[model samples]
Target: MTLNIVFMGTPDFAVPSLAELLSNGFNVVRVYTQPPRKSGRGQKLAKSPVHQFAELMGVPVETPESFRKPSVIDDLEALNVDVACVVAYGQILPQRALDAPKEGCLNLHGSLLPRWRGAAPIQRAIMSGDEKTGVQIIQMAKGLDTGDILLSETVPIQPTDTAGTLSERMSRTGAGLWPRALAALSRGGLTPTPQEGEPTYAHKIDKAEARLNWTRPAKTLDCHIRGLAPFPGAWCEMDGERLKIHLAEPSQGDGKPGEVLNDALLIACGDGALRLKTVQPAGKPKMSAEDFLRGTPVGKGTILT
Candidate 1:
């Protein structure tokens, strides 16, 4: 039997799970997403990725600012959905709305519970130099990501993995795990287990945090650079201009922190050195270190702050 689903999501990360549910013949009655907000250089209103996808799928969509309103809760209850699936919905759900569905709410969180259990799990995992991270399907509670796990799947953190790449992989993995979770839920066989171990909160990454600290160990700096790549990129100041480091790796070398070691874009850190592979100069497109060097020479012995 097809389960009646009310999907709550907003960003691109949530699109795959919504698509999977529809493709698998689940009866998705309605979608709830965050309202369109001003974005980009023009500051024009922009619809969320999930909102655009939901429109294409011909699903009725609601962009509610909050679920605290009695009418909103009443409307949700009117749908009488069997289950509510939430993925990066960008808002704290109210208990009234959570109780609207017969089976309670389920969330597909980006990280394993009790660890990196907050807004920026994927980025935090890589930034902390974790060896592994995974996704968790949980029975949602009112607390922030404090929920019992219904299902989970681990994914390794590769040496070259960035936040963007890791999030893409996790999205697919979580989408694949959904069918199994729904099957178990339908049969009343899905077990909810309490999350174990000490919890580490994954706070939202600020743009200011992307500034590279040359005083840190090379390996730690490498992780920091990779973790924030492709957005709010890890950057350093050179010739009074910001140079965002898109790719870098720890290498053998030592000198005063932030000192350029060679012509290959190697910069000494507190412990070792970092070999910058790709970079983006302020107001310029990303380019290889070699390409960047050709145009703007950063000779050896130059200090980068």
Candidate 2:
């Protein structure tokens, strides 16, 4: 029997799971996504990717400001959904909404919990230099991502992996995992295991954290830069202008912190040095350090604050 499912999600990361369910013939009764908000330099309203995709698939969509209202819960309850599948929905569900579905809700989380169980798991895992992370399907509860595990699949953390790359990998992994987990739930054989060990919360990344601290070890600095790449990028000042570092490599060299070691843009840190691999200057395209140095002369002892 096809189960009645309600998909809740926002952003491109959540798109695959919804697609997977539809492609596999799950009975998706409705989809919930956040209302579009004004964004961009011009502040024009932009619809979320999930909303656009749902419309294309001809599914009913809901964009309530909050689920705390009784009427919202009443509306959801009237649907008689068997389960809700949530992925990066970006809103906290009210208890009534959580309880509206008969078989409970499940979430596609981007970490191997009980670690990184909060808002910025992918960024936190990369910034903290974690060796591995994964996608997890969990039985949703009241606490933020503090849910019982339904299924998990680990992915290795490559040395060169940035938040962008890791997030992409998790998205694909989530797509593959969701259909099977939902199928098992439909079959009445899915067992959820309680999360084990102390949970480390991945607090949201502040915009201030994007400023690169050359005083840190080269390896740590590399992680910091990579983790924040492609958005609010790890930044430093050079020649009185802010420069964003998108990619870098650990190097064996030393000087005063932020001091350039050679013409290669090997900047000294507290512990070692880092060779700038790729960077984007303000109002400029991302380019290799070699090309950047060639265009703008910077040599030994030139400090990057």
Candidate 3:
């Protein structure tokens, strides 16, 4: 018998897994995503990527503010699906919802278990300078990301990879695991194993952490910049304004930390320097360093506070 599936997710990261399931002819009866929220310059209400995708596929979508309500749990129980596939659903599900499905919930997480076991795993892995990170599907438990892993695959963290770039890759690659996991599920052959080793939390990124501390080593700063790239960017004070760095690479240079080394956007760090490749000036669109400098010339010898 085909498993009747319900998918729960929000944001772009979750789209591929849902897509994979549908592509493999899984009977996805419904989808649950976070409520649409106001965003962008106009503050227009924007549907989450998962919500938009589900709607296009003609899957029913629910956007309950919280599953704390008995009705929400009741509604899920009424669906009575075989399994709930969750990926970045953005809420801690109560135990009642977990019991709604016959086989319980399975979460597709962005990091290897026992390594990064909380929110923001992909960003945290890059920020921690890990050479490898992977996606894992785990049997959901009450605790956060503390479930037994069912399937996992490691992916390399390239030197020049930003959080955005890595996420795109992980999403597509991780999608393939859904079919395998479900096949294992239908045959009652899933062998979930408890996570081993010490656990680490990937705490959500705070905007305060985005402030660049030039006193840190160039390598550290490089990682920091890439980890938070393309959103909540790592920034520095430039002539009393914030200059967000979207991309940079460690380079050879030596001077007082935060000193402008040359015209190529090379800024000295505690150990070395970073050549800023992409940046966004305050109140301006993101642009190449060359384009940014063309409009706002930051002369050498000036310190970036």
Candidate 4:
């Protein structure tokens, strides 16, 4: 049927779905991505992954700051798209925009419906120590993530899974679901299921929340550390310098919270202890805890505040 699609997305998570749709022969008429922003030490303008990929695929792109303008809505209506696929587009789509597509807008959300329904879903799931989470494709509505679920797939949360790793898996899962969902929609075989369970909002991750509080249980601390890893990493002050903890595992041990039990970097917590595996000192590259100790030793019995 050569369904006409309008793809709206930004960031790395959205790239796979866009690529999948194109590869599967969906007629993507236009792509909407966030505008490039100043980034890095030099503050150079950086394009989003989706933007670069769309350009490489020879697809037309637009980066309007918002869709509130009447003209913008008019422009979208002019496209006459059959469906709009949105993934992490980074904006609250207005009702007019949602209604523009003939088959309604579909959102690829990175969480099980009715739970973690907001920004930072993946990080929130990991930080909360959830046993499992998944991706949901929902029919877009005016409210935030309060839409009818069209499709979903669950994935387990391993003890070692970080937000970065979990997101990669969820992205692939979403890419696979899109084709089947679109096919069902085409044949009128898809049923929209209302999201069940009490909803939990996933507020955006703030850098301030990444500070490690040694008073917390080892399990909680382990989850927090992994949830924010590879970006705004969970950190602690060691000798008045920030030491980011990238990898750690909970272990059996006991001491005053924040105390270093041994030379292996096994730190005491409110309950149990954590053996740090990877760490990064301020302004330094990530290194194994053993390697970090060789050059700059944190002696046993040293307290980490």
Residue 35, candidate 2: alpha-carbon lDDT: 93
Whole-model Cα lDDT of every candidate shown, in order: 0.93, 0.91, 0.94, 0.93
lDDT tens digits, residue span 245-267, model 3 = 99998999999999999988999
TM accuracy, model 1: 0.98
Clashes of each: 0, 0, 0, 0
The sequence of per-residue lDDT tens digits that candidate 1 reaches over residues 1-305 is: 57899999998899999999999888899999999999988999999999999999999999988898889999999999999999999989888888889999999999988999999999999999999999999999989999999999999999999999999899989988888999999998999999999999999999889999899999999899889987779999998999999999899998999999998989999999999999999999999999999999989999999
The true-versus-predicted C-alpha distance at residue 267 of model 1, in Å, is 0.4
Candidate 4, 1-305: lDDT as tens digits: 66899999999999999999999999999999999999998999999999999999999999988888888889999999899999999988899999999998999999998999899999999999999999889999989899999999999999999988989988989988889989888888889999999999999999799999999999999999999987879999998999999999999999999999999999999999999999999999999998999999889898888
Q: Assess candidate 1 and give its lDDT.
A: 0.93
Q: All candidates' TM-scores?
A: 0.98, 0.97, 0.99, 0.98
Between candidates 2 and 4, the one scoring higher on lDDT is 4
Off by over 4 Å in 2: none
Minimum summed lDDT over a 10-residue window in model 1 is located at 223-232
